[model samples]
Structures are given as C-alpha cells and as structure tokens.
Target: MKLFYEDVNLQTFQAKKTDEGTDQQGRRYVVLDHTAFYPTGGGQPHDTGLLNQARVYDVEEIDGTIRHYIEGTDPLLETVHGEIDWVRRFDHMQQHAGQHILSAAFENNFNLKTVSFHLGEEVCSIDLETDHVSEEVLKMAEEQANELVLENRPIETKWVSQEELQQYPLRKEVAVAGNIRLVIIPEADYNGCGGTHPTSTGQVGTIKILHTEKQRGQTRIYFVCGKRVNRQLGEKHDVLQSLTAKMSAPQEKLADAADRLLNQNKQLEKTVEELKNQLLTFEADQYQDSLVKAVFTDRPVAELQKLAKMIVEGNEEKIVLFVNETDEKLQLICGRSADSETDMNQLIKSVLPLINGRGGGKPDFAQGGGEKLMSAESLLEAWVKQL
Candidate 1:
C-alpha cells in the first residue's frame, strides 16, 4: 500500500523493512513494505526526510521498488519510524496543484497543451505545445488560474482501470494501463498524474506567472505559487526601493532620470578626451629639432603610444623614443620619420633583449614591453645608441 496515495497529509508513519542493499556506487539504501516518501518522478523532485533517525537524502523507484538512499552507516531494523519534511512536502503540493490549475486554464481558454513540466528550487515551469504566447494570453491564463484558486474548487483523485478512462474528459491520454491515477478538477481538467497534491484549490494560495520564453519550438512559462509569490514580490520591492534612493528620483521618474544622467556622462567623457589630445600636441612641439627621448614614472602605456604618434605626425624628420617605468613592469614606444633611413623595428629588436621584452612593428615604428630589469633612462639610451 502507498501511504502517500492513501493520505497525502500523513507526515509520520511506521513501516516494516523489506530489504537493505547497496547500489553500484557503494551507497546504502533501504526498501520498506510501505512508504509515504514520494520518489523522484514526473518532473517532481523526491521527498527528503528521516528514516529511523537516518537522514534520507534521495528516493528513487527502481524495478517497481522504492529505494531510500540514506546518510550515515546505521542499519535498518525490521520496524522503523519515518517522518516526512512537512515544509518541503507542503511546498511541493502547492506548486504541483498550481501547475494543474494553470495548465487546465490554458487548455480551456486557449487550446494550449502542456507538453512538459519542471519543478525547480526557486521557480516552476511548464512547456506548452505552442510556439509563442503573447502578453495578453499570459495575463488571461494567470487571471483564470487565480480565479479557480479563489473559488476553492475541490481536487478529486481516483484510481481507474484502463476501460474506465473514457468516462471522464481527460486533458491528455493516459500512458499507463493498470492502476492509472487520475487527478480531476470538475469541468476544468482530468489528467493522469502520480505526484501528490493538495485537497483544495485554495491551498495553492496564489499563482503568479513570472515570464515566458521560447524553447525548442515550445513556450516555457516560468511561474511561482503560495509563499513563493510573496517572496518574489518582497525581493523586487526591495530592489526598486534601493534604486529610487540611489537615483534620487521617485519610482515614476527613475527611467527618465537615468537616461539624462547617461547622456551627461557621455558629453563629459568626450570633453576630457579632447583635452588629453591637446596636451599631447603641446608636449610634442618641445622636441621638434632633435630626437624626442623621454622617460615617465608610472605613466600609462596608452599615453606613451599617443605621444609617439603625435611626434611623428608633427615632424617626420625626428625620431621618437618614449619609455614608461612602473614598479612591476617597463613599457616603451619607438617611431621615426618617414624619410629616416633607420629601421625603427630593427633598432627596437636589438635593445629589447636588454630588458627581456618582445615587440614588433613596421620598419618605421615599433612598441613592446616586459620585465623591469633596467632603469627607464638606461632603456632609452640603449634604443638611442642602436639608432
């Protein structure tokens, strides 16, 4: 006898142990004559609790037998007490029952068929046969589902033979032949299910559709029910309040305030970039008649590159060598005038080994960096001596 089927509300029961065995992974498990633990099946997770004081971590059906995978090395006695985790069990019940109501509402109102379901840790989802579900259709389905919940309709379960299936208007055909369990909500839905559910629709509390997306040519609707709905609302409200305080704008004006701030930031960035370019132009003019060789302490590599480019662009008759020395590494840039016979690439390569660096460029320009073995001025002197 299945205790869960007999009474879903039965949280504790006594059962006789049938056998104990180990699986291929060396995990110990026990089988009982009767169990209230629902095994992992039909997209619902397995029930977890304690058996004879041993923690039951997993429950699965193998070869028409329920195996309770337990923690600890305790052996199972002939008769043991089992207690189900009521909080987890009741949450599953609410979610499973909510799924039925929503699935039936979709079918009754829009002919959409539920092809698959998954009850996850934070949310649950149902995959519908349709390719797309509009916002209007989603709202309509959600509204209808909550209406049934508010009505507190009775949920009936029956064990019918294969021949007795034709008497009810089943939402889908039954897959099993014998001892088929049909979960029915009068005039709303009739479907074959083995998962446990609540006795009345009102127990489901509330059903909220979070969102939907297309998956493998089907639409998967993400939703939550009961206490989870309240949890989701609380989380979202907290986030909104934080955003409003940080932006110094009310909820209604938050979006517009954000857009304006972004635009202003963009304008400021443009002005700063232009000022940097002008400053580089002024510095390049200082070394117009000779090779521009300079060393900076803790300077950005990007600034060195820009200064090298500006020096060559302003006066193509001069060679430029810029070095930046940071505490951890060395950076250098070399460039020459277009008319210069010296190959900047060859000159840079000959001196790079002194600092254990690597770089490559055209015959007129090159740049690279590596270990900070030598002083910045000494590195610049090596490049100049090669020239």
Candidate 2:
C-alpha cells in the first residue's frame, strides 16, 4: 500500500492499543500507512481509538491519511502496538452496509437519486432528490429493505477489472473505467461505493424508518437499525421521564393538563376584557355634563385611549382626557358643539404650547399629549369658560 505524508512529524505521532487510552495530561497518536481505519467522511464521523490494550479515544483523518488520537496511551507509546477498535468498526460496517441496501431500495422504488447520506448519532439519513414521499410508498420501501435484511445475503467487496465492471448493473449514474471497487450484496443490489460494509445483510439487524421530511426539494429520511434502534429507544424513554418531572404530572395525564391550562388562560383574557369595558362605562358617566361631554381616566394609557373614544358620539362640545398615572403622560382632545362659540383649534394650540406639547385641528376638533394631569381640573374649567 502506498502511504503519503507531508510535513510529517513521525516523532510527535504516537501509537498504542488501549480501551481508555489516556491519563490526565497527555496521550498518543497513531499514524497508519494505508489504514483500514475509516476517517470521518461523507457525513459519517471518524472512529474511536484503541491504545495500550484499551479503547482509544478518537480517530481522525488529516490530509487523507487515518490518524488515531490516543489519550492515556502516551506512557506506553514507545512499546505498545496500535490496533483498530473492531467492535466499533463492525458497527460502522453494519450501518454503511445497511445504508447501501436502503439507498439502492429508494433509487429502485422511486427512480430518485440519493443526494447525501449521513450516519448520525441517533439516526442515519438519506436525502433523495424528490420533494415528496407518501406514507404508503415509504412503508413499501421499508418492507422491501427489511425483507432483504432477513435474507442474510452475502456481501462482497473487491476491485474489478474495467472489462468486468461493464457486465454488472451499477446504481450510480457515473462511470469509472480504471480500477473500480464494487460492493456486491448477492441477490440484493450493487452500487459504486467506497465505504466499508458488513459481511452479510443480516448483520444490519432490523432497520426502522422513523420519519421523513421534505428539504431543499428533496425527501430526507430518518432511520435507525441494529444497535442504533436500542439507543434511540433509550433516549426517548429518558426524555419522557424528564418531561414527567418537569411538567409535575404523571406520564399519561400531561397532555390533558397542558390542554386545560391553555383553555383557562383564554378564559382569563376574556374576563379581563369584560372588566375593562365595565370600568370604562363607569368612568365615562362620572365625567359627563350637559354642555360638555368628557371622558377622563387614570388607567393604563391604552385602556384610557379606548375608553375616551367610546364615550364621545363625535358630536357636541367634547373634551376627552386620558391620564396614565403610572407613566405620567396625559392625552387631550377637544371638539366643538353646533351652537358653541369657542375655537377648539385655537384652544388646543394655546393649551398644547402651555403644556409643552404639539397639536392641531380645525375649529371643530384638536388632540395632543403632555404631562398635565395636575392642571386637568383648572384646564377644563378655563376652556369651558370660553364656550
């Protein structure tokens, strides 16, 4: 096997085989020549390490070569020989193998291309170049893939001659003429894939298509198989337990409790609005007089504004004031009656200048806001004198 290294520090790179490879401070790293250790590529994360007879911490690829990142193995780095973690390696093989089976199944079922495939922590996903995946079709595809999984078909990988590659049907659209690697899962499917795979289909265990969604004009399928299914189930159980404690409800009654709370909140809002209307009506009656129709309130500014508009019938000589006692702001509006002699426009102009505010209107109506609640009683008395 040909190995390539650039700016290679052979001294800094260390090696060993251990489960928990490191102590507190430092660790070892193993650089391989043409490694079978799969570095993270094509959405699959890299493998963990085995150093000094323990499991190594992590495996990564730097510049196309596999590098084992060892933790506690540094002390034994000089004497210990490195080995790949085969259990984890085989698990990855099962997933990658299962992915090939499923990816081929999708391409065969829908004539859709697999754009990207990600083997994630809880689930593996295949992004297909189609916007929609109906439930019925998805179930059928899942059934077929599971059937193939049950068949326990032999999976073979080998480099084939260019002449031999022409005879077999390849799922990928691209063609390769030179040395080609093909993974053949007999009586099942074949594709141009560079990733590792299990020896047999049954090794994939049972695969479940958990969910799917449309993303970027494609259908992204979320799935789990083998040991991953158990992991996903364990995570879901833990989540439900946490929800039970956080919501302060038994597992079965949480949904009903949430629904009841939402309904009660809506009813409370309706009651609040009704009380506001009742208060507005009472406030309007207290401020009314024969020649002058007025509405004034020391409530929230928004509620005061709403009450002020409701008290006036847009007629008569009207003076409405809204005073927000908390925020210390006042709003005033004046309008003329049919027989009134007062100039409402001039009155607002004069009052606004005195209050350090700005307002204007025709002789019939004017409006403005200021911090003038202390002058409210005297201001109304003086303005009514003109009328």
Candidate 3:
C-alpha cells in the first residue's frame, strides 16, 4: 500500500522492507510493504528522505513496486521507519493544487482548456488548448484565480467507478476505466489526476504566471506558487540593486538609462572608426609606388584589410601584402589594384594550408588568419615569394 496515496500529509511511518534489488543502473534499492514516500509520477518529482539510518536519495515505482534507492548496499531492518521530506512534498502539493485553480480560471474567463501540465523544480507550466492567449485574458484569469484561492475552497479527492464519474463536470475525461481518481475544487475544477495536492486552495499560498511561450500550436504558460513567488522576487531584486548602483538610476528609470547608454556607445564607435580611417590614409600615403609588404604587431585583421586596400587603391600598379602577428596566431590581408594581374583570391587560398588558415574574398582582395608557425617577417617573405 502507498501511504502517500492514503494521506499525502503522512510524513513518517513504519513499513516492512519487503524485498531488495538492483536497478538497471546498478543502484541498490529496497521495496516496502507500505510507503509514505511518493514515487515520481504524474509530472511530480519523487520524495527523498531516510528509511531508518539509510538516506533514501530516490524513490521510483517501476512495475507497480515502489523502490527506495539508497546510498549504500547495507541491508535495512525488516521493519524500517520511513520519513518523507515533507517540505518538498508539501511544495509539490501547493503547486499541483494551484495548477488546478489557474487552469479553471482560464477556462472560465476565456474558454481556454489546459492540454498538458509540467511541474518543474523552479517553475510549473500548463499548455493551453488555444494557440494564442491575450494579455488581457491572462490578466483576467490571474485575477480570478487569486480571488478563488482567497475563498479557500476544499480540494477533495475521490475514487469512483466509471458510472459515478458522470456525476461530476470533469474538465477532461479519465484515461483509466476501473480505478478512477478525481481532484475536485468546489465550483472550480474536476479532473482525473494521480498527483498529491493540498486539502484546500489557501494552502497553495498564491499563484504567479512567470511567462509563456508558444509550443506545438499551444501556449505554454509558465507559473509558480507559494514560496517560489517570494524566491523569484528576491532574485530579481538582487539584479535590480546591482544595476541601480552601477547605472545610478532608480528602478523605474533603468530601462531608459540602458537605452541612452547603448546609443552613446554606438556614436562613440562611429567616431573611432572615422578617426582610424584618417590615420590609415596618412600611413598609406607614406608607401611609395611599389609592391608594398609590411608586418604589424597586435594589429586586428580588420585594420590590416583596411590598410592593405588603401595602399593598393592609391597606387594602381602596386600589389599590397600585410600581415598582423600575435604570439599564438597570424592574420593576413592581401589585395591588388584594378590593373594588377595577380588574383589575390587564388593566391591566398594556396598559401592558407601552409599555415592552416581559412578566409576568402574577391579576385582583387582577400583576408585570412592561421597559426603562427614562423616569424611575421619570414611569413611575409614566403608570401612575397609565391608571387
């Protein structure tokens, strides 16, 4: 017998250790005649606690038998005291119960039915039948859900036959034929579920819709309940406090401040780029009419491309080859004037393998970067020899 099924609030009980076995993963587990530990099912996580002195890390129901997986292989007493982690169990109850209320609220206000539900560690979610859910509808549903929670309606569970199921207005049909269990909230919701839930709507504390996303033609609404709402608010507060100190802006003005900072950064970048082009033009003028070749230290590949293009454009007869060197790698940017015969595209490709590099461009201009196996000047000398 599953003690949790009888009463979810039963945190501790003594049950017979019926059998012992190892799962496919080689983890040793013990089965109990009756267990208060809830197994992983119905989108709810397993309950973890202690079976006597052995710490039960996982509880799984495989093939209708509940297994209490522990840390060591030591045998447990025939009759062991089972203690469920009531904090975790109660949290799951609150969340599961809250889901029922929120789903009913959507259905009542917008006629949107819940297609699927998932209870996660941080947040819970329910997939609505509709493809789109308007903000106004969500707001109305949320308001109604909270108002319902305040009513503290009794969350009742019942085991009924197939014929008796017809008495309740179920949100969806039960899958099983014989053993049917329904979770009901007075005038709110009635649905078949195996998950544990609190006895009253007030036990759920409060419901909060975190966000939503479109999934498989349905809108998945992510939400949280009870203590999780306080946790989320605390985490967001920490982030806001940090941003306020750095930006010197209040919470309300932070968004505007961020936009102003982004715009300022863009303008500064434009100014820097214009100044760099002027300096490169002066440097290009110094190169006399000849086949230009030079190596630079700590120079970016983009700057090398700009400098190479400028030099070749000034002297239509020149073919420019520029290389930038760092300790670990080297970048090369080469180009030719319109009248020059050499194809810079094909030339760069052939030598790229020599240094294990990758890049390409038009016939007149090309750029690449590769491992620095040799000195920059020696590498440029090798490139010049290729011409």
Candidate 4:
C-alpha cells in the first residue's frame, strides 16, 4: 500500500480519495488510499506536490494514515491525479543516501557510531557517538564515503519481521517491534530507516564534510551532498575573488594585505586621539586663572568631564562647573582642585533640585543628568553661587 516503497521513482500516480478533514489549525487535508507522497518521518522532511490542482504543502503520517495538507478548501472527489515535486524529492534522497554512506564510513574507519541525524534546508548533519573527531579522522571518513559513491553499490530495502533481524549485520538496533524496514548497502552498511533513498550509491554523486564540532559530548558533522557540493564551492570561490579584487592583491597574498591595512588603521586612530587630547589641554589653559563656570550646547557628558578634570589639574585654586544643554535633558559636571576646601559632592546636591537632576560622587568630583528645567547658564551660575 506504500507507493514510495513500491517504487521511489514513481513521481506521478492516481489515487482514490479516502477521506477529507480539517486539522486543529483548520488546515484542510485529504487522505488517499494510495499515494507516492512520502510523509515526514525518520529525520526526513515530507514531500510537497500538487493534487488535483490543489497545492499540497505538507504530507504527514498520523495513526498509519497519510494526510496531505492542501492549500485551498477544495472538495476531494473519488479519483485525483497526484504529482510529487521531483526536484525536492531527489535532493532529499541524495542527502539521505549520503548520510548513510558517511555514517558507514565513520563506523568502518574510526569505529564511531552515528547517534542522530538532521536533514536541514542548506545542509545535513549526523551526531556521532564520540567526544572528539580530529581533522585526520574526518578526512579519512570522507575519503571512504566517496569511494563507496564511486563504487556505485546498489542500495536495497527489505521488509522483515522482528525475529528475522538477527540474519543481517545491522549497524544499530531497530527500535520498532513489528514491520521493521531495513536499508542495506551490501558489505558496507545495514540499518533501520524509513526515509526515501536512491537505488544506487552513485546517485548520491558526492559527499563533502563541511565542518565538525562537539555538541552534548558528541561530534556533530555538518556536510553537503551531490549538487550542493558544487553550489558551496561556487559560492566560496566568488567570495574569495571579491576579497582579492577589493584588497588589490592576489588570492594568495590577500591575508598579508589585510594585516597591513589593519595596522595602518590602528596607527591612524591613535594619532587622531592624541590630537583631541592636546586640543582639550590647550582649551583648559584659558580658564586657569579663575573659577571656571561654562555651558556648552549639545556636548557629550564625557567631554565635559574631561574638560573639568583638565581645568582642576591646571589650576590648584580654581573650581570647575561644566554643563551641557541638549534637546530634552541637561548634564552637569563639578570638579575641584585638591587644595580647594570646597566639597563638589555637596555642591552638586544643592543645585540638583533646581534642574530636577540626581547625582553622586566623592568630595573632589561629581556628574549627573536629568530633565532640562533650567537654562544651562542659569544652572552653572547657581552652582557658582553655592561655591
């Protein structure tokens, strides 16, 4: 009754509509007596296609029934023509087949067992039951997998009862009790799987291990197969070419060029910062003789603090009060020379009520910001009076 198992190549088929219903989300679905659509299971995604002019977005098996979720609310008739999206179906087949071959290679070469698998949109991954996988080990597994692809070994599936499992050399134990399905690559691998796959190892084309990392005490291997291998190569080549052109260097020399440019940028930044500090020092000298009470328009608070510190450091007799006025707020900074007996923290608290601001600091300096209830000049004058 499983059309996909009967023949994975059967993309088009005619089936009789068995039932129609709506799921909990109100999505309409139809059940067919026989369908070529492969339901989402065994780490493989469901097949998408069209059924009698209605777009079938998802196919899922629930309680031994295949439910095809359709796009529109179209009534199902007795007979309907169903067509699977062959491109997507074949891509999944290639990835699934590649996973099998790669898992077998890991086992045969390194004695690592595959514990889990995930078939993603851009890549597929298998979690191996090991704490670490070295680059040398990964390359060995990849090489062995490609060798199987070149061998063009036949991929066969068999239906057997639970008692007959002892006859085959299964890579892992089968979980289900009844109707166990076994996928076998002769002399290479035998495992329990229900996912669709190509008939031969060559149909998978190639297996490329992209990278690996440790996850949950297991080594997760990310890889691509068949056409995706070529796509990944093309993308990487384009990126390298762009980098070479932008850096004005050949691909081999790009890294050295980038390092040189980075060093130059760091030196330029240091030079600019030194010039800014020099200008601040020069400005602070102008207010060295008297108490400094100045207001700036839309200045950064850090700059105000820097100017206050510079004035206090330049004149031991002077106290500095700096304020900045912005669109919606006012900021204040107060600093005193170490010789000055004036407590800057007490001065800030006394003037904060006038501007509805809050601030705290030691006796030598303080800074804060709040609502702009008073003019910057008036706020600075008030602080000066307090001193």
Candidate 5:
C-alpha cells in the first residue's frame, strides 16, 4: 500500500524517512516513502516546504511517489525529516472543498457536469458542459451553492471497491481500476478525486462568481471565495473613490458629469474652428501680393493645419506659410503655388534642417516638426523670402 493510502492526516508525523535520489541536470531531488505535501496534479499546484530544515522549493510526482526539490549547497542523503507550510495547505483545503460544493450544485440544479477545474493563485474556476445557460439561471445555481456553504454540510472521503462504486451515483467518469477513491459531498455530490479538501461546506465562506463566458460549447465560471472576496471588494471600492475624485463629482453623479464635460469640450472645439476660419479671411487680406499668404500663430497643431488648408483654398497661386508651438516643440507647414516654377521640396529640405525637423509632400505642400522652436521663426522667414 502507498503511504498516502494509510489515510491523509495532514498533521501526522513521518520522521526520518528513507528516500531515493537522482540527478537529471546538475540538480538532485528526493522521492520519499510517505509525503504530506500534495503533488502538482488535477490542475492544482504542488506544495513547498523545508525538508530537514533545508528549503524544499518544489514538489512533483513521478510514477506514484512524491518528489521534493531542495535548493542549497548540501550533499544528497538517503533519509530526512520534512515540514510542510500549514497555511498554504489550508488554503488548498478551502479552494478544493469550495470547488467540489460548487461543482455538485451545478450538477444538481442544472444536470450539467463539470468538464474541467483549475485552482489558481487568485481565483478558482470550473467549466460546465453546456454553453447556452442564461445569466439568471447561473445566478440561481450560484445562490444555491452559497446556501450550502451557510448550511455547513458534511464532506466525506473514503475508498470503495470497484464493484461497490458501481452501485452508487457518481459524477466523474469511472476508471477501470481495482479500487476507487471517492469524495462524497453527501446529498450534494460524489466524485472520484485525489486532491485534499475541507471537512465541511461551511468552511468555504462566501462564494462570488465574478464572470462567466462561453468557450467551445462550455460555460467557464471565474469566481472567488473566503478571504479573496474581501480582497476583491477592497480593490473595487478604491477604483470608485479615485474616479469620483478625478472627475470632481459626487459618487452618484460622476458618470453624468463626465458625459456633460466631454460634450461641452467637443462643442467648444467646433466653435474655435469657425473662429479660426474667420481669422484666416482677415489674414488673407494682409497678403504681400496676389500669391503670398502668411498666417503665423503659436496655436495648437490642429489650428495650424486648419489655417494652412484655408490659405491653399483661397488662391491656387497662394503660398501658405504656417508656424505653431506645442510641448515646447515647433511645427511648420508650407503650401506653395500649384503653378510656381520654384522647387518647394528642395527649398524645404534645405531649410527644415535649421529647425531640426523633416517634411516633404508634393512640390506644393510640405509639413515638418522639431524641438528647436527658438530658431523656427528665422527659418520660416528665410524660406518665404526665396519663394
């Protein structure tokens, strides 16, 4: 019989146990006769601990025995004492037990069996066999599951003969084996499993189903229970408080206030564009000749681009010159006469380097950006003189 077959009393002592050692790479691991540490199996992670006071960093199973990987500068030995971290062990207890209760509830309420289960660091989940169940129905199932937690129902674990197991209702697919280990949640459910669980449903505390999504004809439920519920609630409260403060609105009015502000900002932008167009008409009157239109401002990029387009439309022979400032960076846009004999691209390529920006379009229009705002005015004035 395996050591775990002696009955899993987590508090039981296995002192000075003899074990085997093997080296795969440069590191060695020990396989023990009996282990209280759970192996990584059934989508649940393995346990970590100290073996004879050395750090046992990892646990895994090979064949039927549990192996412990210890990290240190010590030589390998045949026998050693080990101690498991009880808190981590208890957390696994809560999660695995909660999983069984919830899984059983789904089977009883909707007749859907669990297809897969994963017990992770922050959350645990189960995949149901059906995808089409409505939200209200899933909520009903979750409520029923929590009711069991409040009821504090008993959970029994035992081994039964293959012939005897056939006589009772079980949830998992039966394996062709000599004996089967079954976890029974009394009137709630029964299934063949190997992971550790709590003694009763009440220890699971509250369960909250955070989300549910469909995958390959199955519904996967993401949930949290016990202390995890408190942690999640704390995070949500913090987010709401920060949003309220940043929006400068009372908690109840934050959403509406944000929408109003956004709409007003957008309306102001439209009004400003109209004002810019009106200003461009006035600037066009100050043109040096029938062809030269210079509109200079330290406005934003959007305003500068709009003014440039207005200049080009006013006269096909128009030479549009623009300069703007944003984030201490300078931007320049130049649009020349479509019938001009001058090479505007060649002119820009020579002048743009003075402002440390690069831009080239057709022989008509060019745009550029640079950090050298101090020398931008001279560069623009010099380029316009030649054009």
Candidate 6:
C-alpha cells in the first residue's frame, strides 16, 4: 500500500521487509511490502526520513518496485518502522498544489495552458504554452490564485475508473486509462494527477509569481509558494538593506543613487583614457631616430602597441620595436611607417622563439608575450638587431 497516495498526511507506518540488497554504488536498500514514503517521480523529489535506526536518504520506484535506499541499520530486520520527514513532505505539497492553482488560473483566465512543471529545491517553475507573458498578465494570474487560496476551497482527490471519468471536466487527459486519480478544487481546477496534496487551498497559504523567462517559444514562470514567499521576502530585504548602507541612500532612492554612481565612474574612466593617449603621443614626438627602440617596466602590451603606432605615424620612414617587462613575463610590440617595406610581423617572429613566444600580424605591425627570460632592455636590443 502506498500511503502517500491514499493519505498524504500519514507520517509513520510499519511495513514488512520483503527483500534487501546492495546497489552498484554499494549503498544498502530494502524493499517493503507497504510504505508511506513517496519515490522520486512526477517532477516531485523522493521523501526522506528514518527506518528504525537507519537514515533513509533516497527512495526510488524502479520497474514498479519501491526501493528505500538506506544506511546505518541492519537490513535483516523483518518489520521496519518508517517515519516521513513531515517538513520536507509538506513543503512539497504546498508548492505542488500552488502550481495546479496557478496553472489553472493562466488557462481559465488568459487562455494559456501550462505545458510542464518542476518543483525545485528553492523555487518552482511552470512552462506555459505561449511565446511571452507580460508583467500585467502574471499579476492577474497571481491575484486570481490567491483569491482561491483565501476562499479556503476544499481540495478533493478521487480515484475513478475510465468509464466514470466522463463526469469530471479534467484539465488534461489522463496518462493512464485504468484507475484515474484526480485532484480537484471544486469550480476552480480539476486535473489528473497522482502527486500528494493538502485538504484545502488555504494550506497552500499564498502563491507569488517571482519572475518569467522565455524558453523554446514558451514562457517559464519561476515562483515560490506559502512559507517560501516569506523566506524570499526576507532574503531580498536583507540584500536591499546591505545595498542601502553601502551606497548611503535610502531604500526608495537606491536605483537613482546607483545610476548616478555608474555615470560618474564612466566619465572618470573616459578622462583617464584621454590622458594616457596624450602622454603616449608626447613621448613619441621626442624620438627622432628612423629605427626607434624602447624598454619599459610593467607596461601593458596594449599600451606598447599605442606607443609604437604613434611613433610610426609621426615619422615618415620609421620602424619601432618596443618591449615591456613584469617580473614573471615579457611583452613585445613592433610597428612600421606605411612608406617602409620592413615586415614588422616577420621581424618579431625571428627572435620571438628565442624567448619561447608566439605571435603574428600584418606586414606592418605585430605583438606577442612570453616568459621573462631576460631584462626589458635585453629584449629590445635583441629585436633591434633584426632591423
């Protein structure tokens, strides 16, 4: 007997241990003649608790047999005392029932049907058969669902034969035809389902639609139910409080404060970049040699490219080779004036392998980085020899 299907609130039971074995992972498991534990199925996770002195971690129904994978107790015991983790089980019940109510709301009020559902660890999601769902649409569905919850309508489950199914207006067709199990909220939602649910809509507390995303031409709604709504509220409040303190703004003005700070940072970055380019151009104007070479400490390779480009552009027939060094690595950049036939790309390649580096570019410019096998001046001197 599956107590989960018959009595959703039944927390304890005594069952005969019919078989015991070790799986491929070496975890011990026992099959019982009867159990209250719910297996992992129908998008709902398995129930976990205790069997006598053992901790039941996972319960799975394989090939029509329920296996309660456990540890810490002797499997040889004939009669096992089982206890369900009511907290976990009841949370699942709340979320699952909320899903049905919310799904029905979208279908009945908006002509959108829920294609699928998932009861996650922190949130539940339902995929609707629509390309998009607007914020206003979500709010409408949420309000409708909560109204049903506030009404505290009775949630009834009935097992009916295929012939008797004609009397109830099922939201969807039954997957199995023989004994159809339906969870019904009278005048609200009637659907074929085997998952456990509470006795009334009030037990679900409230349904909150958190957000939505587009997936494969459908809209997936992410939400939390009952106590989870309060948990979500507390978590978000904590985040907002932390942000307000850091930004020195009141909760109501946090968004405006953040926007102003970001704009200030962007303006400062633009001014700094203009200053760097001016300094590089000034240094390039000081060099008069046709073959210009320089070495600097801890400069970025990107800046080296800027300095080399400036030098070549300022001189009619110049070839520039620049090197920068950090303690752990060396970087090089080579450039040439448009009038020069020198291949800066080939020139860098000739001595790059000596430092175990690899790079290539057009005939006029090239850049690369590698190990700091020598000083910045030594690297510059070596590249200058390639001229």
User: What is the lDDT, from 0 to 100, of the residue 368 in candidate 3?
Assistant: 87
Candidate 2 C-alpha lDDT tens digits along 115-152: 88898766789998889988988888888888899999
Write down the TM-score of every candidate.
0.76, 0.58, 0.89, 0.79, 0.67, 0.88
Q: Model 1 reaches what TM-score against the true structure?
A: 0.76
Query: lDDT by residue for model 6 over 71-154, one digit each (tens)?
Result: 765545798899999999999999999999999999999999988999999999999999988888999999999999999999
lDDT of 1 by residue, 1-387 (tens): 679999999999999999998999999999999999999998899999999899999999999999999999967789999999988989999999999999999999999999998999899999999999999999999999999999998998999999899899999887789889999888888999999999999999999999999999999999999989999999998988999999999989989999999999999999999998899889877776658888988878888888887788746577888888888888878888777877888888888898899997888888888898988888888778886
User: Candidate 3, residues 1-387: lDDT per residue as tens digits?
Assistant: 977779879989998888998889999899989998888888888899999989988988898998889987677889999888888889999899999999999987788999888999999999999889988888889889999999999999999999999899999878789989999998889999988999999989999998899999999999999988889999999999999999999999999999999999999999999999999999989888578888999987777778888888847678988888888898888899888899999888877787888988889998888997788888888888999
Off by over 4 Å in 3: 279-289, 313-315, 326-328
Q: What is the C-alpha lDDT of each candidate?
A: 0.91, 0.66, 0.89, 0.92, 0.74, 0.90
Q: List the residue pairs that clash in candidate 5.
A: none
| lDDT by residue for model 4 (258-355), tens | 99999999999999989989998899878856688888998878877888898898466778888889999988888889899888888889988887
State residue 347's C-alpha deviation in candidate 2, in Å: 20
Who is ahead in TM-score, 1 or 2? 1
Model 5's alpha-carbon lDDT is: 0.74
Model 5 TM-score, all chains together: 0.67
> Model 6: what TM-score?
0.88
lDDT of 5 at 108: 84
- How far off is residue 194 in model 5, in Å? 1.2
Best by lDDT: 4
Off by over 4 Å in 4: 266-387
- The C-alpha stretches of model 5 lying farther than 4 A from their native spots are 1-12, 15-27, 76-78, 240-387
Decreasing lDDT order of the candidates? 4, 1, 6, 3, 5, 2
Candidate 1 yields a Cα-based lDDT of 0.91
- Kindly state the number of residue pairs that clash in model 3: 0
Please give the ranking of all candidate structures by TM-score, highest first, separated by commas.
Answer: 3, 6, 4, 1, 5, 2
